[model samples]
Target chain A: MESPVDIQDLEIRLLLETMLHRYGYDFRNYTHASLKRRLLQCLAVCNITHISEAIPKIIHDRAFLDQLIYAMSVTVTECFRDPPFYRLLRERVIPLLATYPFINIWHAGCATGEEVYSMAILLQEEGLYNRVRIFATDINGKSLHQAKEGIYTIQNMEEYAQNYQESGGKASLPNYYHSKYDLARMHSSLKENIIFAAHNLATDNVFSETHLVMCRNVLIYFDQTLKNRALRLFDESLVHGGFLCLGTKESLSFSEISDRFTPVSQDLRIFQKKRGIR
Target chain B: MKSPHQRRAIVIGCSAGGLQALRTLLPELPPTYPLPILVVQHIPANSTGLHTTLLNHFCQLPILEANDKDPIRPGWVHFAPAGYHLLVEPNETIALSIDPKVNHSRPSIDLLFESAADVYQKGLIGVLLTGASQDGAQGLLKILHRGGITLVQDPKTAEAPLMPRFAIAIGAATKTLSLKEIGHTLKQLGADTRE
Candidate 1:
């Protein structure tokens, strides 16, 4: 007999296969270690004892599958996450983006919409907001709906304020939002130019040609093959001299597409597409 | 008990006041130490990677901050970078994640320990050191349940005792040793494996 862990992993593989065949949500290509942990976590939350037990429910019940997919997707995010990267953008990158006649910016895997809105706030301060149209996309429809509303807890303001100031905001953070009871609602001006939609990086092709793409902290969960596929998608869409931003923990050094982009800020995980390359 | 020759990797976890202990422990292992070491040390999300640089500056082994899909190799040490959960794959590679933090820490000790346990099973050795939180306890217990050796810093010797105390409370530790003794034990294992 196989050990329990071996059986569990095998069951996880079967579950992933069922999800893909039944729903077309391809988790089969995700990094194994995290995929396993997430499935186990979802299993516990669903009150199921074993991973295989959920496979049948997931196949027969649409609501159950959606709930499982929501849990399985990694969506950890914060407003103005990684203040220094924002500082680098607000100080340096956005200015170059300002030079463009009209820019298209894509925030891929923009869970809950915090960082995408943060970008709009900075652009408004820079007087670059009106010229730029931002497309914030994610794989989860539930997260997309929340992102569209542009509302977050008032309790987050203190941390958001600190991060905004450190991201080098000259105006007070309150200038960007209105508080009602317990919610912080972003000003309508920031929302007007942003179009929130559902886009799957794994299966979907490029949405449009873009000036900049910010997919921070999303690609680290993917295996190398999946990451390369997404990078290739970005490569096809990014205009020459456009930019790509990633989290500090990620790098292009080992990627197949690294040759086409040079480091704008290696420390900040920003890369500028080579003017000579496509 | 499995001999030193049978173990494939070593995992160490710690939090508050762990730097002092790591400084003492990691620096003493000889350059020829034969097993890969994976470490999860709690740090702020916005850390500048200075500590990893400082530790690599003096340690006999080549110490580097882990990157995504990095191969796990012997005689080198990989520390989980700030703001990512480091995991070991059955393919003998390291994977990083920004998954929700466990125990309020991004590079959570429990995630590292549990993931490593899944990959290495009875071939793994997990160590818990000084920490203020109860993060590593469950992971240590997991390693124990997988038939791997669970070594923890004796709470009496730990700078902040809650972490190891929790592990011992759960009956997780196979042995609890002082920092010096743990260091010596690892070095002895390395020597025995080399021969």
Candidate 2:
């Protein structure tokens, strides 16, 4: 007899397939344990026990699936997560990038736009803001909306402030946001060169060519195969010698395309696409 | 399937202000402790270097950010690279899986603890330390259910207390100690000494 755990695993696989086929959102390649936890959470929230029961409900209810997507999507992010990584960019990468007349920077999986703002601030400090266009994308609509609004809970400001200072901010962190009631609304000027949109790394194709791509803390949720696929997309999208920065735990070391990109800062998980990798 | 007394490995989960806590805890452990120590610290995917550098500075034990399919070994501290869940196989080897994020984290404490519980069962000791979220509670419970020792940091002494508090409230922890005491206690428990 198959164990209940095995049965549930199979059911989850079926549900993922059904969801992919029906809604066109591809979660087919996410890590299994995380996917299972997400599905279980969705089932619990929907007040159902079995995938059989939840699948039907989710199939007919677009809103329900949207909730499920939000639950499943990896959205946790902060401004200048690795301060030194940003510091490195400012100290090393930006000067070279400044030589270009126009720069297109992509912030993949830009949850709530904190990193986008951080990047915008960095660009502004480097005098590259006017020459740059940043495309910030995430699959979560709610987070995307929040990103567009440029607001955050006041509770987060202290940490963001610390991060900003560590990231070598040229100005006071508080200077970027205005306090109203209990929330801190970020300055509108930071969004001047930014465009926020909903784009799925799993299902969406490349939208633009760029000088740099920051997809930090986002790829670790994907299985190795999906990671390769995403990296391939990034590889194709980046211009020659364009930079790709990932979370510290993430690396391009094992990818099939590892040779196509050379390490900019191996410890910081920063890479630069080779000049002639077609 | 061995009894708790016969267990051979320890897994720890921590997050949110964990760097300083880990610096305090891990450095006290001797270089030659007897069992392997695996850790899951909730951090951004691109930030493994910070943990790697910090641990290297404090612990005499060899510490490396885990890679996919890396084998678990004694005398080393393996941290789940940011953005990936680290799991232990039944054979005591390490595996990386890229599922969705759990408990709002990728390198989730719960994911590591639960998988360790499955693989090591009574032979595991699970530790929950300072963190902001409730990620490790369910996994610690699984460890307890499987007859593993579950240690939680005393909330009052933790940098971030929500995680330890949650584990205590849920009855997931076998013991709760101050960070300093936990470090000494872990030393006695045999961390990464056996070559």
For candidate 2, please provide the TM-score of chain A on its own.
0.97
What does candidate 1's lDDT look like per residue over A95-123, in tens digits?
Answer: 89988999999999999999998999988
**Clash number for every model?**
0, 14
Q: What is the TM-score of chain B alone in each candidate?
A: 0.97, 0.93
Q: Clashing residue pairs, candidate 1? A: none
Q: Which segments of model 1 are wrong by more than 4 Å? A: B1-3
Q: Best-fitting candidate, measured by DockQ?
A: 1
- Encode model 1's per-residue lDDT on B78-195: one tens digit a residue: 9999888999887888889888789998899999899999999988889999999999999999999999988899999999999999999999999999998999988887787777
What are the lDDT figures for the candidates, one per model? 0.90, 0.83
**For all the predictions, what are the DockQ values?**
0.75, 0.14
